[model samples]
Target: MAEHVTPPGIDIGTMHPARRYDYLLGGKDNFEADRASAETLLKFFPATRINALENRRFLRRAVTFLAREAGLRQFLDIGSGLPTAPNVHEVAQGIAPQSRVVYVDNDPIVLVHARALLTSTAEGATAYVDADLRDPARILTHPDLLGTLDLTRPVGLMLVAVMHFFPDALKPYEIVDRLVRAMPSGSYLAMSHGTFDYLTPAKRAELDALLARSGEPAAPRGRAEFARFLDGLELCEPGIVPVSEWRADDEPEPRPDPAEAAVYGAVARIP
Candidate 1:
């Protein structure tokens, strides 16, 4: 087993977005602080757990579409959370053994468990870069990402359920645009972002308050605002629908309620 030393500037006492998400996904890599933060959100919006699960499922489906359908051989997954079953590499390598992946996240815990992400098929490759999404340049230029994936080729960029953390001041749209611009013409962007479109004004306010109290406030965008993230890219079929409805493998089975799964998912080509 490989070991990764916890880097400086990590405060375990404070709640971290990745750890909170890990707890939401039923993973044991979270602390009490993370749990408390997750519980707070659930109290305000009972559908949060369901939404998290649906968003995760959407990620798997989108990756499958990119690797198995789009024939993309490389992936650059930004803000990739704690290691979970059927991860990006597993799904992609399962379809095409030659697939390559680069997982990027700023969380120290993610780095500690990065060994799980490093396991790749004999023909494929996997690497982890400890970087923040706010710094697209750093992530794009990281040696591990560059070593594992060829930027010149079509790469699937996964940004599932992660961008909401960036507020307007951070210019999330520009950040995503910069990343998309870095990829080749055929590269695809598979994204799922949290939204308040389904919530009542009161419920939305309560959710916002809870997020602020947690010390990591997130800005849940509306449908129109979220669509702007893919401005220059060409959207794929079943465009910008709720996570549960975006090219779902289990169709006609009464998809999860959009209100419960308040996250929008889509895939777009750079061209």
Candidate 2:
């Protein structure tokens, strides 16, 4: 695979979730540590690449639904990873040119690349906030976010392929609810989280041990545990299914089984 020059000051020895995800998606912005961690993950979950692509496809479909069906024009995407094609703004603006997007991530590389390269249309607006997902208030109140998106209005909150990094100790549920509470009633929330529901008990144990050993912070919860993030929200159709099976009408034919993807995905509206 191709590689990009690491930006100065980044700890290249450590594995970053975004870079590991980019590596999984065949991108060129990962380091040796990231690739090694990804390969180690593949040992317990052989379909790691398929799971990553499935989650990426799920994010695109959710954004399309929000832009077209949900009639949302503003979006706040937290834990936004490396700049990939068809980003939140790219997908949203394609459906509605006036759509506004605020991408948030703690990774300096993501922030630098996104701010430097990500563009917006004349009608729509785009901005990047250098913040961590754990600090939802900071992201919601960032000057760049406020300048770009009006929080008083309904916003599509996206937390795709990123929550797995925050295990129970991080209180992921509370973090999600805090962000949701900042938005209006009609605002929509779209998320895809890693899940161990499809894995056997032994496999789950092995995966957990592997992650601990590799210093990878991937904590894939079960279905019931993952559902807590969307509690009290109005779930869209086909709620809480594997990312590969959630609204696969536009996906390529012969979708992968839920076990292969091993991630729960859904879209909901704050009521």
Best by lDDT: 2
Q: Which stretches of candidate 1 lie over 4 Å from their true place?
A: 1-9, 249-254
Instruction: Give the C-alpha miss distance for residue 81 in model 1, angstroms.
Output: 1.0
lDDT of 2 by residue, 55-167 (tens): 99999999999999999999998888998887989999999999999999988778778988789989999999989888888887899999998878999999998888887
Please identify model 2 stretches exceeding 4 Å from their true place: 1-5
Model 1, 71-118: lDDT tens per residue? 999999999989888799999999999999999998877887886556
lDDT against true structure, model 1: 0.88
For each of the candidates, the C-alpha root-mean-square deviation to the true structure, in angstroms, is 2.6, 1.4
| Clash counts for the predictions, in order | 0, 0
After TM-score superposition, what is the CA distance of residue 186 in candidate 1 from its true location, in Å?
Answer: 0.6
- lDDT, residue 216, model 1: 77
lDDT of each model, Cα atoms only?
A: 0.88, 0.89
